[model samples]
Target: MEAFFYIVPSLMIAALLSGVWRLMRRSRRVARAWGGGRTAQARCLRSYTTTSGGGDTMVSTTLHHVYEFTTREGRAVRFEEANGPGTTLEGDLVTVHYAAGHPEEATATAPAPGRLLAESGCLLLFLGVAIAFCVLFMVTAHEMFAETDGLMP
Candidate 1:
């Protein structure tokens, strides 16, 4: 049906917006934590490979690293980071940035500029297309209703 065109794009736009909102909130949380967090030395306890999407097509894999550190108050904390597995090895020393209030939420690596730029570009492109499709849908609906009104006795 003609309505499919409008419904599909509308759903996609909603999904994209939701994803962007979540990412923004998470980034803000991490940024706030990093700004007020303390620094500590952590050791990479182990590394593992996670695989997804295989079979006859292409397979994707990511390496995850688990690190542990002791807080100033002598509390032990462990965090897993999938961003920089190749950069560290078991027993390797890593610098960790963590908020004192939430030591479990820590990161050993900063977000990559290239990846950030790529994501921004993709989001912008999708937003532009979605807006255009929405306008088209509205115009088509209006025209259809106007024609029907004229046809009725």
Candidate 2:
């Protein structure tokens, strides 16, 4: 049981770390190559439209502003989830970086390595780590409890 606890946490942490590392590295390289350019940072001005006196009030509509990155090859690319009413606006000029090899590979300015790996935000990377920690804690507690009670349940 103890061995299982150690192995499970180690694997979970390894996977999470690998994913976070990859994203951080990719984002960093992009920033280093194209930190300053013709990037536009626009504020996300949103408007909700709905029908009056309608039972479908729960349904909502919004106009999202997206950022477009024009690579040197005349190709346009945008960051993932970096669009919509919740993200930066259309007219806002945001610092962006792109992959020289694949123009389509672009994103908002690369975050600091430390920030990318261990920062508090709504990013998927952070979420992955958080979930991994939760699982690890649960597994460890269960193993400890099972060992003490000598019961499988």
> Pick by lDDT: which candidate is best?
1
Give per-residue lDDT, candidate 1, residue 19: 69
Per-residue error for 133 in candidate 1, Å, reads 4.9
Candidate 1 global CA lDDT score: 0.76
Cα deviation of 147, candidate 1, in Å: 6.0
Model 2: per-residue lDDT, tens digit, 34-149? 64443433222332333334485565454433456566666656544332334454466666555466445555544454564344333565758676685869676777777878
Candidate 1 per-residue lDDT over residues 1-153, each given as its tens digit: 446656776787787688677766656556544664588899999999998887887998899999999998999999887757596889999888778888887888764546655776687677767777776886776577578773422
lDDT for 20 in candidate 2 is 66
Which stretches in model 2 have alpha-carbon errors above 4 Å?
33-65, 81-87, 90-95, 110-153
RMSD (CA, Å), each prediction: 4.4, 8.2
Q: Per model, state how many residue pairs clash.
A: 0, 11
Q: How much lDDT does each candidate structure score?
A: 0.76, 0.54
